[model samples]
Target: MTAALRATGVALEAASLIALRQVALRSRAEPVLAALPGGFATRRKGHGHEVADVREYVSGDDIRHLDKGTTARTGALHVRQFHEERDRVTLLVADFRSSMLWGISRAFRSVAAAEALALIGWQGVSEGGRVGLLALTPDGQVAVSPRGRVRGVLDVIGGLVRAHEQALQSVMAGTVADRSLDMAMSGLERLAPLGSEVIIASGFDDMGQGMEQRLAELARRRVPRLIRITDAAAGKLPKGRYPIRLSDGRRLRVSLSGHAQTQHETETICGRAALLIDAGSGVEQTARLLAANLPADRAP
Candidate 1:
């Protein structure tokens, strides 16, 4: 590789690492007390022990939750209401396909996706919740079960870094795979428990058949988040001929002067997601968007 390409690679890696560290630090100051409340709201009522209120007993109210003292004093039946404590499992799914290997801006889409995953994992862990990862690489899928504390977050980050390195190597060797995002989503369905909060980060280039059905099923029981990693040049190639080098030491000239945009304008996953991340926006911008969208007690 040329010195310029190597330098760009290094810069991309460094930026991602910095973004991870910043997210970790910020999470310590303000924990995600609620399970992604705003966009990721589960809409399921809390079942915690903390009393929220009390009201007259309804026909369908749980008889066991009836307030005995209140019923006796008022000569009427009443039920105790408790505050809802959200489930604490956070799962991050990332795509590492060959398509992510290309970038027209500062760095590859894969790098940005990795950075976003790291940030979200760290943030979830800092809030005293268990975090896990499901990585879709050129070779196959890698799954990491959720774990509590900082160590779990570290493990997920390590996996992301390794996947990014592997993706770069695959691109160089012209050995990239054409895996679909649906495979990763299927893995998520099996691993993630009901009521878990899930965030999927990817370019979403290859969404296989029946993907909509899978997403809908997951959304019914879990809070879903989507991060769309894309290049600035996607669907907007300049009007000129350009020389492109292939991984097999071959150069090809391509013209885009009259090429109409062929990429899809929207993603099916967006319909089921509460939040979306545009990788072309850079780390800081993405982080800010997450902080704003995520449900937390204070600004992260």
Candidate 2:
């Protein structure tokens, strides 16, 4: 069995998350929080106190906002326009599939994913936004609705820990598979609110067909950030033939001496990711990379 499958202990705890928050607060001007679109202001109009403009009433305009004095003086129907400052929703999608259970670094890919999730979650909540979770595991999937303030952040961290434990159990039993990622993506579409910012933390080893289309559809309405987590071993394989065993008790032999495996893994995982975080990298490095890559306009 892989070391990751047999690993014990919680990869992340509430204390770790709290520490991260303290660090983030100290470096508030570093743009780390701005990496996530969750902190950015949205353009969706709503009934707010701040008047944006005053214009002639249109057929579809809300009648309740009609300006009676303007209509009477100009003999034309007018409506008051207002702009609302809405909080952005940040959804953390953690992939706990069998593939994520393998790592040759300081921790498992799943563990790295959980750490990244925590950092992003804290950043979103600190920026006055809501945080939610979508954990996809071999045993099953778990969804936590977005909550505001500290409660929401804690809920997401709790969900990550639970999903990791369940995934570990599945790995130990050798019942892990790779069919839940597609389903999780589907769930993301249904559960995500309009204009929400989504962070997908995974290795993308089992990215199924039609994933690009689904992501395209999601990007149309929401900001989708791909935090691709991979181990160093995945990029380079020693020249030799290796025996591989399937989760279903099947055994097969494959040659890793050639570049085929490396190329395939790169195309499958790295090619599609917007941001790549190595499993061996530190959590602070991941946060800095994400912040640096964010658009200048999005920076807080």
Candidate 3:
């Protein structure tokens, strides 16, 4: 049992995630974190009342947007650019089923998922957006509503820690997995607003039925993204005998005869994901991957 515990990565405390706030703040100036997915890469441009920028007028510029004071002072037509005023809300959905408790490196898949969400949540908060969480654990679901600034990320971190600990306890007891990814997805509609940025982290262990259809429907109403956490051995294993630990803390040796390929339905369900991070990746690396896909010009 000691050896098994040592081999597997353990759960993370909420305090450990506090440093991610600094990482998120530092990433704001980094060039690697410049790109975001289509929805977040560009700000929503419109003729709304909220002024985003003021620049010298160009050909075909809207006459109504010409700044009279600026034009008269500079002797050149100046136009004001408007961006739609949107309430930036980021919703993080995490899956902590029994399957996510095991991994080959750095941390368990569940822990890695928590780290991923923390990084993203902090980034959202730093950008003047609200962050929330909906975690599906073996014990049940834990939900936190969207909130702005550090308070919001703190709430989400607390939820992640609570959900992960409960899942670890359930694994030790050999309990059945009750939560489903489908349920979490359905709950997004209720928890996330119409224009919310939804990010889901899961190993896709129990995605259940009709996931593709359900995801497509959710995408229509919200900007939903995904992070598929994985372990090294989950892909392909050499044909040989290997010792492994069961969720119930029992050790067992299993023999493999052929090369096994991991056949997950992640592509079918989460084709819109721009990031694919491994469970072995530490928090900083995970955060970097997420940062690379987030908009650099998020409003303060």
Which candidate ranks first by lDDT, i.e. highest? 3
| Cα lDDT tens digits for candidate 3, 1-300 | 234543436756777788878877776566674344465432443455767888998999879899988899999999998755445788999888777877766788888888888988888766557889998887688899999879999999999988877777777677744656786555668899886778888877667787767788977877778778887555556777889875445799998766666533234344564456778666666666666666645432
Please provide TM-scores, in order, for all candidate models, with all chains considered together.
0.67, 0.71, 0.73
Instruction: List the candidate 2 regions with Cα displacement exceeding 4 Å.
Output: 1-14, 26-28, 31-86, 236-238, 257-273, 294-300
Local distance difference test values of all predictions, in order:
0.67, 0.71, 0.74
**lDDT string, candidate 1, 97-172, tens digits:** 7667667766777777777777777666555567888888777776888886778877787777666666666666
lDDT per residue for candidate 2 within 166-235, as digits (tens), equals: 8878877767665846665667877789888888989877677767877778878887878778776655
Two-way TM-score contest, 1 vs 3, winner? 3
Model 3: residues with Cα > 4 Å off, grouped in runs? 1-9, 33-37, 41-86, 184-186, 233-239, 243-271, 297-300
Task: Give the least accurate 10-residue stretch of model 3, judged by summed lDDT.
Answer: 262-271
